[model samples]
Target: MSLFCHRIEVKSVQTAGIIIEYNPMHDGHLYLLEQVRAQLGADTAFVGVMSGNFVQRGDFALLRKHARARAAVESGVDLVLELPLPWAVASAERFARGGVEILSATGVVTHLAFGSECGDAAALERLAEALHCEAFPALLRRELERGDSFPAARQRALAQLTSPKDAALLSDPNNILGVEYCKALLQKKSAIRPLTVRRAGTPYHGTDLVGAQPSATLLRTLLRSGERDRALALMPPVVRRVYEAEEAAGRAPVFRENAERAMLARLRSMTEADFARLDEGREGLYRRLYETSRSACSIEALLDETKTRRYARTRLSRMVLWAYLGLEPAAFPRQVPYLRVLAANGRGRELLGRMRKCAGLPILTKPADVRELPPVAGELFRQEVRATDLYTLAYPDLFAAAGGTEWREGPVILP
Candidate 1:
């Protein structure tokens, strides 16, 4: 059968995989979960989630990772697994690969469902096919020579082969992330099929969603505004209740400029070799970093100074994240060594039981549970600590109340 036919056939699966980062569990996420559960019956869908010190958006999880996971379980997620630092922040390709790989690794997920404007699963598959075309390599090389970053180079190259306006296809963060999901599923060649859910609410980052709810961006914006009650208004009752409890316990969420600055300062101190070591280091990227580091006062500022058509802001941000963690692309763990249980309720717990018997990876339930970390695992954990330290620094009051920890090896799970 054609690749299109194969993907279409996957809609009839039992369990589905959702790759998400619910910065603050909001109504939009609830809507997505409802759709997933409706599409595939209960207990059948598996949710492989990412929760760490930082999010893909290059910020702290509004609520802690464990809290976010619990929210997922409360919402109806069956399983929630942690996304490692490399996959968590590397790039769209790595994130998708990591997410798909984790869900696929569980050995229970049969369908990979996600929100997208592209609508048609077959079209995304076609896009995926085009992305891997034999001619793309040469075309990409030409674009790169024109001083475009890898992402920009690929987009421009694809546009040349396809439509002139097609460069916009991979521009949005959502679409870029979507394409990566398709690419990851294809690269792994796993039985778990890929599906894209037509977005029903607002755009990925759109702030307004009148009757129903606002996007996570909107919610974060409100929460960051110090209007905790108003910010809590954007989420579901369960989420608001949870946030309320955390708030009552003295955990008022705040954007951590200090955390970001600490990380940025570390980035500024790095030499060119350090930049090259943390992936995205090729051609003149090292040179760009060496030059940009001289005047960078913050992570966002450094990105603004160095960003160009050749080096997208997001790409630079990911590279900076890797640098903070000391994660070199050359040293990434070849295979997933373990699945850290971040959060799960009864259903999530049930899925975990199934994963135990079927999962190919070791499941980590405790923070100290690193008996068998693949090569980069230790360093990856260290990066997470750095991120948390940054997070704590940003919320000194919160951190101070919560022991103001340096880093703990074991499960720092909430609830």
Candidate 2:
């Protein structure tokens, strides 16, 4: 089996891999899917590794992962797999690495596709190369010592090492992640080729719905604010129906505020030593978190107290979320051990048949299949199970919240 081959053989299957959160599966996501299919050919299999209940923005997803996966397949994606909790809530580099690893392990993806503000694959690759140079770390450390945040310090370091033009690419969020994806591919020495599509319409952090394409951020705001019709209008018809069904079942529009008290209780109960273990930066952030948790009454208040010029609010949010979920940095795996299916269409089923022999990792279509894998895989699955149980506590209908749902539920298969 050629585990990470980038080259496409004559008249062979061509697969395109994408990393997505699809928090609500809006028009912008649909546009990317359409563009990739048009560029890669209609028959090219598109596999998306989606974030489960938690998203990279350091918050709960607007909807459940399986519901979003169903919307993804209905909208156009061939297959959807879980990105796993550790990677889903991690920093940009690890998030990109985990997504890339899952795609490469499939042994089928030829191109890793993503949307970028720069939309220039060569420029992103060059930026990735600049960050990997030996002298870059010293330069970055120098900038950090000046009390600049990580994002700012890294950009300055790149400007000094590369050209200002190359460093400016990091100004855009998509470009930053695109560069990380390329860096991950380079680090793994994998054969997967990086591909970028120019991101169009509203800015990534845009807060209001506008024009033909709106950011997921805007839609999420609308959903949480009870502007359901406006938010659903931005989504595909099938996706709208899916979200509607979830709403009817009292499972839609999950927010951090729903479980705010629980989160604060968990954080307040932790010791300074516990916070130290969960801190990834080793920048004495745990001390700030420990101090802040005592007086801070709400999650927002805790984040407000802990926020600093050097530490972004998003980073602090992840730390708080991990503490709430009992996730220690040590528990996060160095490598992804298996792929868990979320949803799939007929074409995805065909791809799975081929993956059985070629895949680099074990595939889990049913939760119980985890028993056949190594102990590490089982441990990860157990974490996922516990995560699902905790996630249910945030449901709009308390009666609908139930444990052991992860074990009884299987992947959503569409004929």
Candidate 3:
């Protein structure tokens, strides 16, 4: 259960891992897989470490992780590993670190591929190096002291130290996360090389369905508005099938608005001390949250009330969700505890077998396996269980909403 351990030698076949949320599997994701596979050759296994019911954007996924994992495997991924709740909902730095740690622990991956607005891997690595320098901290601190947001401060610091082209890359969301992935790889000193595919089709935050590959945000909008056919067209055939099946069973679309009441109630019951324990909860922000929760009728209202120039709405939303889920900053393990398999095809199963021998961390294939974890790891696992229970509460079907789906559901096996 040591947090930082020596990296073990990889023993399995060549594999590539992608870090993703896949709120709903879309063609853009498939394109990345295709590009990676084409570059690496079809023999190379593709593993995806995906966010669970919750995501980094500080919200519940449009569909559950299992469903999304299944779609991923059906479309192209050889395997899908669950990125635990704590890290999945964390900021980009932690999210990237957690994912890189898990993928590295698997002892099979040779490359870490990610979508980047700036497709140059070497350039991103240089940016990562600059950001990791000892001098960057003092420069960043000065920018923060000037009241700039964390992202803005980091960007300003980078601009002062690096080329304008490199600094501008941070402004794009995909590039920001891509830089973090590289940073995490450097932090771990992992042997896994980083690869980036230029983002195509729609921008990350675009709202319109442009051509065949619409943004996940646009697809979510379409699904929420009952425009199923339109959304389906933006995804691959296999992914479309999964979405259609989930919707038919009354469990496809789960939005933030569905949890508004539960979120507000959870916030109202907590004191400033309780809020103080959440990530990014500090500097009287907990007091602001406590006050806002008392009068704000909805999650949106509470967000609007508490959000400042320094804090983005997405950060506020994540904080509220963390408070609702009773997640404390200390609850996260210093190192990722395990790689929980969400879905796997035959080739994936082979990779798992090789991983069992060399993986530095435990590889969990079922819910029962969580019980064998150390106290710290088990505590983190329980957070995921609670997250599943809370997430199911948003399902359209009452039976599904009764909870405990995490225990009953196993890794999705695709033929």
The TM-score leader among the candidates is 2
The positional error of residue 326 in candidate 2, measured at the CA in angstroms, is: 0.5
* Segments of candidate 2 deviating more than 4 angstroms: 1-13
Per-candidate local distance difference test:
0.69, 0.88, 0.85
The TM-score values for the models, in the order shown, are 0.86, 0.96, 0.94
lDDT of 1: 0.69
Clashing pairs in 2: none
Best by lDDT: 2
User: Which is superior by TM-score, 1 or 2?
Assistant: 2
- Candidate 3 Cα RMSD (Å): 3.6
Q: Where does model 1 exceed 4 Å of error?
A: 4-13, 148-153, 159-168, 208-211, 249-254, 372-386, 398-415
Q: Name the TM-score of candidate 1.
A: 0.86
- The best-first sequence of candidates by TM-score reads 2, 3, 1
**What's the residue-level lDDT of 376 in candidate 2?**
90
Give the Å error, residue 231, model 1: 2.0
Ranking by lDDT: 2, 3, 1
